[model samples]
Structures are given as C-alpha cells and as structure tokens.
Target chain A: MVLTWAVIGKMTQRDPLPDGTMRHSRRRVLRVGALLALGGTVPSLTGCEPFNREPPPPDPLAPMVDEALALAAAYRDAATTHPTLASRLTPITEAHAAHAAELARITKVALPSATPTASTPADSDATLTGLRELERAAGESATQACLAAPAERAALLASIAAARASHLEALQ
Target chain B: MNTRTPGARSAHAAALTAEYAAIWAYGPIGVRLTGPAQEAARDAEATHRRRRDTLVLRLTDAGDSLPADQAGYALPFPVTDEPSALRLAVEVEERTAGFWQAAVAATSGAERERALAALVDCAVRATRWRATAGITPLTTPFPGRTA
Candidate 1:
C-alpha cells in the first residue's frame, strides 16, 4: 500500500518502459499510477472514467510479469551468446521463465512477446558479473513489491526476491 | 508481533518454532564440520537465537501466549558424516524458510519485513550449502514454495 517516491516516482511521468528494451535500455520510467487505471500509457487522473466504457482495473502485479520475462529473455540471450557457458546459464534462464510464467498466471496477463537483444560482454567472467548486477537490482525491486503488495500475494513476491539474491550467489 | 489477525499469529507461532529448531539443529551441523564451514554454522545459529529472543519478547510484551521451544529437535536424517551433515544443514535452512515465507503473507508492517528478511537469509544460506555440496543449479526459483 505504500508506494514510496523512490519506487514509483520516475515511473510517474513517462510511458511504461517499452517491452524488450528494459534490460538493455537504461532504466525506464513507469507510469505506475496511470497503469493502475489500465490501458492508458499517459498519466492522467481525469481520463479514467470515460462514460461507462470502463476498462478493468489493472493488476499492480502486471508490471512484475513484464520484468520477469525481460530477465528471462536477457538470460536466454546470454546463454545463446556464450554457448560454452550454456550449461551454467540455462538453468537460471529456465528459473526466470518459471517466475515469469507464475507471475503471469497470478495476474492473468498474457506473456508479452520478448525480443531481448541483450549484449553480453566478450568474456564469460564479465558476463556473469553483468548478470549479477541485474539480479541484484531485480531482487531489490521484488522486495519492494512484496512490501507494497496485498497479503495474498506477498509470500510469492518475497520468494521471488529471495530467489533472485540466491541466484546471484550462484553466479559468483 | 502484536498480531492483528489469527492467521498472522499462527504464522508467527510457527516461525518461532522454526527459529528454535534451527538453532538446535546447528549443534549437530557445526560439530560435523571444520574451519570456515563450522564457523558458518555457528554464525547461522547465533542469528536464529537472536531472532528467536526478539520474537519471544515481542509476544510476551503483547501478552500473547508464547510457543514453547522443544527440549530437543530430531534430525531429519542421520548426520554421522560431512555430506549427510551438510545435507541436513540445507534441510534445516530450507525448512525454516518456509515458515517465514508463509508469514510474509500473513503479517504486515515491521513483522512482515522481518519475515521477508529471514526468508532471504535462509535462502542465501541454503544456496551456499548447495554450492559447498557441489550441487548443480544452486538456487531454487521459488524458495520455500511447496508448489
């Protein structure tokens, strides 16, 4: 229930980060409040009620599904790029895909088509370091989401955050 | 933990039992190890002890009935050797994590934060145990999840 400015502030002024670009592109602002109103990329308080043509109120968890899929796509891309390390990376990639699937199931949102163009470093060691950073940020996001989420969904969100942290340890 | 709902109270009580058992389980875990690994068990046990104390105090202050710590907890499996012992350590952490994870959905405010933190700690410890045991795919996608 508590949306700190730090979590939702940047996301307030702009469109939801475009799909497929969240991993590569710099952090995108989310139109969070607007997103809760659904089907609107623009952040407007006045535009929600359009004379009985009411869109369903969006699940706050929908954004999380997108985040999970983006992470999965990025990991899959890394596995493809580093074929020698595919054995190590593939399980983690599968884990992210599972997370995305579960989040989608909970939110009842279809998984977006993910065309991740993740650029890995030339070396496997550096690539792992990069992945660890991504995992760290994603972990923080999931923890914040857990704190702000409803009681019914908090356990799953907390598990996701803990998993992200543990996954980073494996990367080391 | 002045639990507002029965669900929250039940979850906390269950987590309290886990904290007690985890601390007790570490004795056997720490004994069957050497060097850094033994130190890790000691540290983990100390952490559980601290959390358990806090929970007891909070419940007492609220005039809530405190859950009893058992005289001793049985090991999940034989811990006669290093590999078995390490496996038991992982089991203890993972089992303890389940209660805290459940608590996250039952409680709110600072209690929920504490539960989330405990779950993350257990998951990280479990990962390290798996790595030490040379287990592949060192992390679970959803720690503490039965499904």
Candidate 2:
C-alpha cells in the first residue's frame, strides 16, 4: 500500500507544457493531494471521523447540472426563434435536459428551479454557430472536471465531456 | 459477497485490450467505407494505434503487467456491407470509450488524464460513425454510460 501510494505520488507530478509551465491548476493540485491522502493506508486516519468531520465544500455536480440545463435552454430558445431549426435542435435540447436530470439524480441534489437564460441569436446560421461554441465550452469544462475528479466521479464526468464533444460535431 | 477492489493497473489493462480490439476492428471498417469515409477510418485506426503505444509505455514504466493482444477478435456482427461496417465502427468506439471510463475511475493524475482524453476521442469518433450511418440524434446524453 505504501509503495502504491508512492507510485501515485510520483505519477501526479505535472509534466511541463510546451511553454515550460506545469500543467496542473492550483485547484487540481489540491484535489490530487486530497485524493492521495485518502489513498494512504494509515488505519487511524481511514475511519469515518476524518471524512465525517465537515461536509465537502460543495458538490461539483451542482455546477455541472447548471451547465447542462443552460445548454438545453439555449437550444430550446434557438429552436423557438428559428422555427425552421426546431426539428433539428429539439432532440439535442432534450438530450441535455436528460443529462441534467440524471446528474441531479446521481448527486442526490434537487434540480434547480431557476429558468435558464436563453440565447437570442439573430439568424439560423448564427444560432447553429452559437450552439457550436456553447457545446465546445461545455465539453472543455467537462474535460477539465474529469481530470480533477476522483475515481468514483471521473467516469460520469468523462462521459459528459465526451457527449459534449460529440454534440459539437453534430451541431456542425 | 466479495469485497475486493480492482486497481489502476487492471483498468489500464482493460483499456489496452479495448484499444487492441479497436485497432483490429478498423481494418474491416476502412475497407467498407469509400473516399473521405475510408480516409477517416484509416485516421481513426492510426489514432488508436498511437494511444495503444502510449499505454504500453506508461504501463511498462509503472512496472505493471501488460496484456497481450489476441491474434484476432470476433466481430460483434458480420460486417459484409457499408451499413454494417458503419454500425461496427460506432460499436467499436462506444465499447472502447467504456473501458476508458473505467480507467478514469481506477487511475489518477497523468493516467487519469490519458483515460479522459481517450474517452473523449472515442466519443467523438462514435458520433461521426453515427452520423455516417444516418442514426437519428447523432449524439448521446452520456457517451459511455448505459443508463
């Protein structure tokens, strides 16, 4: 166990980017450290006490759910404004809604009731382009979240990220 | 009930196996496609190969045992035509992404990054295959998740 932890420690050190800066963000470094500390085999520290001491700062899923909802709303608004694109946009919007619901269920959090601010693109092509940009940003966020997440949540985050990437392609 | 936990090595091994299968599967997928589609299949195959090579190096450096690729694999279904081939391509990418998702759960740090990137790659490829196949929606709410 000790050897395993040491191996993980060595592996977590960020590689230099092309510009010679470390790849990890400060938040990622902290998350990695917390994950490593949890991975350690010290029996006394493994009890429920440490984990139960304070609730985690916030569930990352909250923001993820919000993003999904917002994306869905944007698609819906786009569809309403450009009725011609409704048939094409509706399915993607519905998929986003489903994603938000599933994420909320998994996190055991109540869904947010706030209405999403919709995109007011001027024309059909602009709507599609705006959607493509939205999907790209969401995909990037999900990718970063996947990298920062622990083992249990990583799969969900990765899947969401991948879905968003595909959404971008489909939007094109 | 068994309480055993599988580690990062096991997950990485699973991903390697999926990559091996993906590389083999693309041979049939490419032959059935034409023009740009065929070129795309070839590019996808190369991507899997590159990932496989990287995984081999990472596992080797970590002193983890590597799984040997099979001489051949059984296709999920017969790929005798273009439609079947496109479907197989989609299946291949989705299946490979599943393994990478598991790897994301089992590994950490650089290994996790690799798994996440691979997962995204497979997802995007799967979407393209779906589009080529004329599958409706063309994207999933969750790429790797079955439920």
Candidate 3:
C-alpha cells in the first residue's frame, strides 16, 4: 500500500527523460541490483552469473530533473513569445531553472546543454493557462516522488512540490 | 517486517508545535482585520486547531510522545495594521509549512501524506496572503526551505 517501488516505475513511464542522465546517482545501485535480481536478467542455467551486466535502471529522480528543465523551458518560451508578460513569468522560469539545477546536482546528472524550444500559443492567456496546467501536473508528480523518496531526499522534493503548487496562484 | 507508523518522532512533534504557534498567532492577526479578511483569519485559526487536535490524537495512537503547546508564542513583528496582520498570516503559514516539510522527510505513508497536505495548504495560504498584500512573486522557489 505504501511505496512498494512501483511509484518509481510509474514515474519512469510517465516522463521520457534523456537516457544520458540515467547513468548518474550511485545511490540507486541497490534499487538497480534489486531490479536486476527480480527481473532474472541472465539466462544461464546455473544462474551463477553474479553480475547484472544490463544497464542500470534510471535514477528515480531523473524524470523530475528532466521535468524541471522542461518546465523552465516552457516558461522561458512563453516569456519570449509574450514579452508583455515577461515581468511576471520570468521569476517562475528562474525558479524552475534553480529547481532543475538542484535536482541535477543531487542526481549527479548534467543538464542538457541547450534548453529545448517549445512553441507558445498565440494567446497570452492561453499560454498562461497552459503553464498553470504544466505546473499543476509537475506539482503532483513531485509530491509522489517525495513520498517515494528516501528520507534524506524527501525534503527537497517536498519543497519542489510545494513551490510548484504555489505557482498556480502566481499564475492567477 | 515492522511498519509501526514510520517516521522520526521529533519531526511530527515539531509540526504539532507549529500548529500551536499558528493558532496562537492568528489571534493578533484576526483582531487587526475586519470583514472577509477577519473571516479568513478565523478559518485559518480553526484549521490549525483541527490539525493540532488530529495530530495529537495520531501521535497518541502511534504511541509516540508529543510536545506540549505553550500558553503563548512571541510575535515576530507587532500586528499593528491590516497589512502587518496579513504579513504575519503569511509568515505563520510559511513557518508552519517548514515544520511540515521536515515531517514529510522524517515520515512515511499516511503521516507523510498528512505532512505534505499541511505543507501544500500552508504554501497556498502564504501565496494568497502575498497576493492579497500586493506583493510580488507570490510563490517562493522552495516553499519551506529557510534560505
């Protein structure tokens, strides 16, 4: 009923993160080992192949890191598309950048060199609404990640989640 | 496998203490405002009271000891005007959310959920207060992070 590691798998399927970032976060060795053992990665009859040569499972926080970067990009694009709203939207974009940087640091994942460019809707109100929805979903995902995280990591996830949730009001 | 309401006991106890402080501070905040703002203060106080009672019961059920609520908490700044009261309300919620955030780290399962709900609730309220006071940047980058 409570965090059976299924949550991490769920997040993995929900967000398509770059495979490059998956190599980081050594803390995941145990989880990866558990996954390999459970998956029966080897076909050898003796099952004595102690090594799980298959690539490591993606770090559970990688998607969040990716999501943070995406949100930042979306906000940045929105700001660029609608210069009149830049004053209000710039701070949120900056916040997401900070969140992404912190998450990347914690996971030992390097951020993408170039921020992806996303097309913004023609209507500024529509763009703002779209941003709000993204923030809302991001907040919900971060909340789940916080619950699934180990104690040491939960605090940052909690803050990220809360910050995202508060952004709804900022958008309004 | 043991799963007896897992979390650090001290964290939730501290959250309980925060609720007590929130409830206490709302008195000065409520007195400074009239109309809907006053009502908002009343609702906020009642919310804190309910959470305090619920947490007390939960800790008791979990066989975890609780810290007692004090008679009063010193106000960070005097609530002299409507603006100041609104500001205090925001501060109270933010500070309360910090404790809940720590609880979220220290806890798991239902306790973590409760702490998270409290944190979100406080963050939202803090935002509302900021918006109400005409402050810029309604949301903080990290709601409960002190720095």
Best-performing candidate as measured by lDDT: 3
Error of 1 at A152 (Å): 1.0
Shift in Å, residue A24, candidate 3: 30
Error at A164, model 2, angstroms: 0.7
Report DockQ per prediction, comma-separated.
Answer: 0.80, 0.55, 0.76
| lDDT per residue as tens, model 2, A1-172 | 6654553454456657789886655565566456557766433333322223554455767888899999999999998999988877888898889888978887888888986889567878888998998999998888888888877787888888888888888877
The CA-based lDDT of model 2 is what?
Answer: 0.82
Q: Estimate the TM-score of every prediction.
A: 0.82, 0.78, 0.82
Cα displacement (angstroms), candidate 3, residue B28, comes to 0.6
Worst 10 residues of 3 chain A by lDDT: A42-51
Error of 1 at B39 (Å): 0.8
Deviation (Å) of B118 in candidate 2:
0.6
As a whole number from 0 to 100, the lDDT of residue A154 in candidate 3 is 89
lDDT of 3 by residue, A49-144 (tens): 223345555688998888999999999999999999998889899899999999999998999898877779999999999999999999999999
Compute the lDDT of residue A95 as modeled in candidate 2: 83
Tens digit of per-residue lDDT, candidate 1, span B67-136: 8889999887888988888899898989988999999999888889999999999999999998887777
Question: Model 2, range B60-107, lDDT digits (tens) per residue?
Answer: 877777899999999989999999999999999999989988888887
Please state the CAPRI-style docking class of candidate 2. Answer: medium
